[model samples]
Target: MKLTEVQEILAKSSQEDWIVDDESGSFTYKNDLNLHIDRADFDSYREFNEPWATSHPDPHAVSVEYVVKYGSSFVDKHTLVSVDGHRATLPMPKSINDLRVTESDVNFAKIVNIGDRVDEYLKRARLVEVEDNE
Candidate 1:
């Protein structure tokens, strides 16, 4: 999805984005947050599993909850998980929603209220314009 579209969705959505600070110390969006991409039908939402859940549906592969498949930015102050601000600065065609990343990264940003209103918040932070959102 386009970055602007993601921002618009986030700006318009009623649900507050969730953040998960894993034991690994990496802060990410809700576990399996974007699991709704396709294939399954509300199964992921019903499970609402956390990263630490032992009985992941796909036991063969690394648990999607724990891995940094998406929402890879906003680890902690001064330490970035993905190069660009995961959600906010991510390259388009990312598997997950940019809005989700944007919300979480800004949620735990170095400064509070920065993610509350992304346009003004990111601008005030002086973060480089995420080309994807341009």
Candidate 2:
């Protein structure tokens, strides 16, 4: 992606709540969670917050709103149910690298697994064996 495009994504992501994704298809609360920690652990997250805040300054602090808008072609519209009972159209990136198509872009359509909740994805079954002697 072009520097401009990356800057746009960074701006938009900074505005909203962000979720972190592991390259291996897992999701987590921390951006680098998959690198050196357990997927279920978040105790260290707070330890990094202050340092992160100091190290990474907000781009918007410098009056850089232009860095957040993207071309129409890069975004996809999704209908979400609002609390007011109205369907709201939300703009989402069609691809991870929506600003520029890349070989590393994940094909969300193939992995979304719609209608399946994370609990359902985590459910498992155990097998039991019986012996005739018993």
Candidate 3:
């Protein structure tokens, strides 16, 4: 499979919300959740503002962490969802390197699995990208 084909599949499956950032050389999906994918390496995290502490007048206590939660803050603290193990490397054809299509690109099925993982992550995060009909 070619890189372009993979990009097209992700774009369609993600409702065109997944965009390729040429400068970063990675695919970025930003909605309520923010995801950055570089080759088989990807990072998923959410950003939100934490309530201000009583001692501090500032209310902009921003926090970022994986979407999945584990236990209470005093216990295990928030942890990553077990998406087939943390940072599970999605299968990709060896022909593809750094999101660039090599001359020997093949294995269409593996390329498709990459898209599947992306969709799965979005779903696991309680986010289903859908077209805005309005």
Candidate 4:
């Protein structure tokens, strides 16, 4: 997927619950839930079997909330685990220079709004192009 694709998809959706945080260079969308993506870093990696429920009745059944796999110097994959144990893995860009947004990434991230409204918001925030037609 590409950034233009993301913009196009967002533009066509009906939901308007989206946010772009300039301070952190992150975007968030809310439906019944929230999905967030950080533009700056991907350092929040965790082991699948970490003891998240150390004090729970089923300590050994600790849920693996999320994981980040790396290759060489860049992130290779990002996985999200739901409370019910379902998992979804998304391939990441090889480097910052190759960073681009995809539909799956947006869907998995639960991004809601996009298009002209979002562009207008980004414009007001000065985070994207300021031209009227952009």
The collision pairs in model 2 are: none
Task: Estimate candidate 1's alpha-carbon lDDT, on a 0 to 1 scale.
Answer: 0.28
lDDT of 2 by residue, 16-108 (tens): 123434333232212322211112222311221221112222211110001111232232221111111111111122322332221111112
lDDT of 2: 0.21
How well does model 4 score by local distance difference test?
A: 0.32
Instruction: Give the clashing residue pairs of candidate 3, or none.
Output: none
lDDT of each: 0.28, 0.21, 0.29, 0.32
Query: Candidate 2 at 69: error in angstroms?
Result: 7.9
* Top lDDT hit: 4
- TM-score, ranked from best to worst: 4, 3, 1, 2
lDDT of 4 by residue, 82-118 (tens): 1112222222222324333344443433332222233
Q: Report the alpha-carbon TM-score of model 1 versus the true structure.
A: 0.20
Predicted structure with the largest TM-score when compared to the true one: 4
For model 2, the run of ten residues with the poorest summed lDDT: 59-68
